[model samples]
Target: MALLGGIKEVPANQNSVEADELARFAVNEHNKKENALLEFSKVVKVKEQVVSGTMYHITLEASDGGQKKVYEAKIWVKFAWVLMS
Candidate 1:
């Protein structure tokens, strides 16, 4: 999957795509059962910035029951270059 705008782009693999869809469906269903006021929940925006080296700072915007919320997450990615002899 290619990272775009911070929201990890959906994986190209069919199985991964299916799994993501299923997870979203499950969450929606669970919300419906737990709270009648929540109509739906979805991601609104995503931003990513490099902190240092392979570390990154990610910000996520989302809405739940019409209320907006922001969340922060940190991640580290490693890149390797191989030399063939």
Candidate 2:
């Protein structure tokens, strides 16, 4: 299945599976920073149709010392290629 519309919000209870996986990836890639933790907050699309070659907007949150900060990130996804592999 293709990644459809981006995740609009991160639920208060627990994160979506997609978010969890992405969070793990982010942790592996960026967890070394001191005094802060980064989390994937939401995913949005730059255009209407979130198709095989569409770019997605990623919303992230960074928490440090009980305060939180936010950021926007972007990435291109190739669903067909990923599904094929």
Candidate 3:
């Protein structure tokens, strides 16, 4: 499924399970690396690009120090590895 394609927006709804999970992972990873406490809120948007596996660009809202803020995260998931930014 790695035919390589341009980035495209995926169907993003409030109940998107994969997007939500990725958002959570992004927040957790960020908290661990930055030592900043951030609470995962919800996924606001989702996009994907076919890379070696798949690159997911997600926009999410999270509580930062009790303030709700929107943030962007890029996660490259290739089954064996997950890179977050």
The prediction achieving the highest TM-score against the true structure is: 3
Error of 2 at 68 (Å): 0.5
Give candidate 1's whole-model lDDT: 0.43
Candidate 3 displacement at residue 35 in angstroms: 0.2
* TM-scores vs. true structure, each candidate: 0.34, 0.40, 0.83
Return the top candidate by lDDT: 3
Go through the candidates in order and give the clash count of each: 0, 0, 0
Question: What is the Cα-based TM-score of model 3?
Answer: 0.83
Q: Candidates ranked by lDDT, best first?
A: 3, 2, 1
lDDT of 1 by residue, 1-82 (tens): 4443343433234344434343345445546787643332333333333333344333334356678655443445455667
lDDT against the true structure, each candidate: 0.43, 0.48, 0.88
In model 1, where do residues sit more than 4 Å from their true spots? 1-53
For model 2 the TM-score comes to 0.40
Candidate structures ordered by TM-score, highest first:
3, 2, 1
lDDT of 3 by residue, 1-85 (tens): 4345788888766339988888899999999999999999888899888888879999999998899999999999885676999
Residue 63 lDDT (model 1): 58
- What pairs collide in candidate 2? none
For model 3, state the Cα shift of residue 10 in Å: 0.6
